[model samples]
Target chain A: SQTIHQWPATLVQPVGSPLSLECTVEGTSNPNLYWYRQAAGRGLQLLFYSVGIGQISSEVPQNLSASRPQDRQFILSSKKLLLSDSGFYLCAWRTSGNTGELFFGEGSRLTVL
Target chain B: AQSVAQPEDQVNVAEGNPLTVKCTYSVSGNPYLFWYVQYPNRGLQFLLKYITGDNLVKGSYGFEAEFNKSQTSFHLKKPSALVSDSALYFCAVRDPRNKLSFGAGTTVTVRA
Candidate 1:
């Protein structure tokens, strides 16, 4: 079975701090990866998606950026975090197929003080 | 512009009764609809999806959704509700590039 792993399950940083959240997929290759952020009482907002290594499509313009360094590794980074960046960060992957549901990781809760 | 609308902010039903969470979409091409459930503090879990062929698709946790192209809606349904089903439900539509556009989500409170 495939599994998605995200690290630093919870994080707290002051405004203007650097941010880095990692996500990795297991038991699958050549998958499409995505990054989403969910604020309190709000639906998820798509941040970025990667079709392959070095190929990323950004949906929302914000303080965050994402990278697919490997087939199964995706990273979300920020040079200077803002208080608005505080939210539940989620990473997802789907099989390289026409019809595939997104599989999500446990998610990281980031709190910017 | 592709989008999904989950009309209701919440739905309430008693245990063992029928339940529904409405969803509608607007897309140019064929609509790929999906339903996902999320518990508090947990990641979203895929419930069901309608890709092609069948209008009625069954998925995990005894949940199902009916696709109506004419109405441009894909509403999720279940015969008997469980108290454990009380959680947040989301309806999503796949865009032209297979990207998902989700609604604001609906909270289902299945009272015991």
Candidate 2:
């Protein structure tokens, strides 16, 4: 059985503060990792995806950046956060190769004030 | 580019009556469809997926979906509705570009 874990279930930070959200997966290796954000009354937006270590594909231009430091460890970071950066952040992992479904982690809710 | 469309913003159903939440999709290759449910303040839960053979895919919580190639639709259905079934339902398609293009979710309200 595989499970995804994200930290800082809820966060409150001042504007322009640095941000870091971590996601790790257990029971799977070489899984494709993704980061998605959901705003209020909006659909999930793909932010970044990593197919392998040191290789990441960013889908949107934003203040956020993602890194795959280890095979199963992904991190979303921002040097300076803005009010627009506030939202629910989700991390997901899918099997390598051609797979449709993505197993998501319990999201991290960030409130920028 | 593959994409999904959930036409309804909300669906109201009476308990014990059949319910259908509509979905339509567009993909380049064979469409791999999926249904997910999100409870309030919770992550999306996987319901079902259509990959290869069967058109009628059954999933958790007594939910099922039918894949239609000609109509380009995959509608989620259940024989009877329950109060606990009320939640936000999302329709998705595999972009195969390693992304799941999801629809703006539909909120289903099961009236007791």
Candidate 3:
């Protein structure tokens, strides 16, 4: 059984501080990884996705960036965070060549104070 | 490009009653539809998907969805709603470009 892990479970940081959120998957290799953000407890917005190491695709232009340093390890980072950058960040994975069902992690809630 | 639309923002249902969350979608090719549930402060959980044959697809937690190609709709349904069923439901369509587009999501409240 494959499982995804994300942390820190919750964070509170001041504006302009650097941010880092990590995600990792076990029991699977070369799986597709994705980052999504949910704001105001409503809609979800795609942030980034990676098919392989050192490959990242941005869905929207924003203050955040993602990187795949190692297979099954993805990190979301920002040099300087803004107040608008606070939200619930989710990490998900799906097998390559599959239809489109994704397994999601518990998620990281960031509050930019 | 593929996109999904969840018409209702919220749905209120009594426990043990039928529950339905409406969704519609648009895609250039055959649509791949899916349903996901999210509890407060938790990540989205895959509930069901419609990739092929059957118009009705059953999934985890006794939840199912009906894929109506004619109407371009895939609605999530449950015969008996439980108080635990109260959560956020999302409808999604797979983009041919190897991504997925999610709807605005519907908040289901099952009152006991």
Candidate 4:
């Protein structure tokens, strides 16, 4: 079975601080990885998605960026955090096909102050 | 240009009663619909998906969704609602490139 792991489970960051959130999938190779953010009272928004290593498609233009260092390792990063950046970030993976089903990780809660 | 609409922001249902959360979608080509559940502070969980074949698709946790192509709607339904079912439900539509466009989400509150 494939499992997605994301950390740190929760984080408190100051304004203008750097941010880094890591996601890794075990038991699957060359999977499609995605980064989504859920704001208060809102649905999940796709931030970035990668079909392969070093290839990322960004959905929204924001302070956040994503990178796929390895086949199953994805990272979301920001050089400087903003108050609006605070939200629940989720990492998801799906098989490399047209299937729309995605498996999500536990999620990471970031509180920017 | 794929979009999903969850008309209701919140739904209140009594336990043991039948529950329904409405969802409608718009897509240029064939629509691929899906339902997901999110608990407080937790990630979204895939409940069901409607790719093809059966209009009535059954999924995790005894939840089911009916895909009405004529109506352009895929509504999530449960015969018996439980208190544990209280959470946020999201409707998503898949684009040609396989990217998912999500709706605003509907919060379901099952009262005891």
Candidate 5:
């Protein structure tokens, strides 16, 4: 069975502080990974997606950035955090097939102080 | 290029009653639509999807969706609502690149 893991589960960071959220998938190889953010617990906004290592496509323009160093490891980072950056971050992955449903991680909650 | 819309911000239903979450979408080609559910402070769980063939698609947790191509709508339904069914629901459309475009989401509250 495939599973996705994301961390840190919860974080409280001050403004201008650096941020890093990691996600990794197990039981799959060369899967498609994605990063999404939910603001105010409502709509989901796509942040970034990677089809393969070192290949990331950004959907929204923001201070946040994503990197896929390994086939199953994806990292989301920001040099300086802002108050508006606080939200629930979700990590998901889909098999590298024509038709595969996405699987999600537990999620990471960031509260920018 | 492909997008989805969940018009209602919230839906309230009594337990044992039918539940429906409406969704409409637009796409240039054949649509690949999906439904997901989210609990508070958790990740979105895949419920169902509509690619082709049958107009009615059944999914996890006794939930199903009807794909109406004529109306460009895919509405999630449950024969009987439960308190556990209260959560946030999202509708999505997948583009050719396999990127999913999600709707604004609708909050469902199944009262006891």
Candidate 6:
């Protein structure tokens, strides 16, 4: 079975502070990883996706960035956080050749003050 | 552009009644539709998907969705609603690159 893990579970950050959220997948290799953010009562916005290590495609231009340092490790980072950056950040993975069904992690809640 | 549209923002249903959450989509190529559920402050969970073959697809938690190509809709349905079924539901369309475009989401509230 494949499992996705995301951490910090929850965080409170001050404005202009750095942000780092990590996600990892176990029992699968070379899977597609994605980063999504959901604001209160809004749809999820795709932030970044990676096909392989060191390859990332950004969907929205914002105060966030993503990196695939390893085959199953993906990290979402920001040099300086903004108040608008506060939301529920989710990390999901999908099999390379499979359909669009995504396996998601528990998610990280970030409150930027 | 590939996109998904969940028309209702919220749906209220009584327990033991049939529940339906509407979803429609627009995509260039063959559409791959999917449904996901999200609890409060939790990540989305895959409920069902419609890739091909049967128009009626059964998925986790006794939930099902009917894909209508002519209507461009894939509506999630349940024979009997439960209080536990209250949550956020999302519709998605997959692009050729395997990226999923999600809808705004519909909140389902099953009253006891």
Tell me the tens digit of each residue's lDDT in model 1 across A1-113.
99999988999999999999999999988999999999995599999999999999999878899999899999999999999999999999998875857988989999999
Off by over 4 Å in 4: none
* lDDT (10s digit) by residue, model 4, range B1-112: 9999999999999999999999999989788999999988888899999998999999999999999999999999999999999999999998888888899999999999
DockQ of 1: 0.72
DockQ of each: 0.72, 0.75, 0.87, 0.82, 0.72, 0.87
Model 5 lDDT, residue A68, Cα: 98
Poorest 10 consecutive residues by lDDT, candidate 5 chain B: B93-102
Cα lDDT tens digits, model 5, A1-113, are 88899999999999999999999999989999999999999888889999999999999899999999999999999999999999999999998875656889999999999
Q: Between candidates 4 and 6, which one is better according to DockQ? A: 6
User: Candidate 2, which CAPRI tier?
Assistant: medium
lDDT of 3 at A79: 93
lDDT of 1 at A51: 91
Cα lDDT of model 2 by residue, B8-109, tens digit: 999999999999999999888899899989887777889999998989999999999999999999999999999999999999988757689889999999
Per-residue lDDT of candidate 2, residues A1-113 (tens digit):
99999998999999999999999999999999999999994599999999999999999999999999999999999999999999999898998985569988989999999
Q: Count residue pairs with overlapping backbones in model 2.
A: 0
lDDT (Cα, 0-100) at B45 in candidate 1: 94
Per-residue lDDT of candidate 5, residues B4-105 (tens digit): 999999999999999999999999999999999999999999999999999999999999999998999999999999999999999999987888889999
lDDT of 4 by residue, A1-113 (tens): 88999999999999999999999999988999999998894788999999999999999999999999899999999999999999999999998875788889989999999
Once fitted onto the true fold, the runs of candidate 3 whose alpha carbons sit more than 4 angstroms away are: none
The residue pairs that clash in candidate 6, if any, are none
Evaluated at residue A23, the lDDT of candidate 6 is: 99
At residue B107, give the lDDT of candidate 1: 97
Q: How high a TM-score does candidate 1 get? A: 0.97
DockQ versus reference, model 5: 0.72
Q: Give the alpha carbon lDDT tens digit for every residue of A77-99 in model 6.
A: 99999999999999999989997
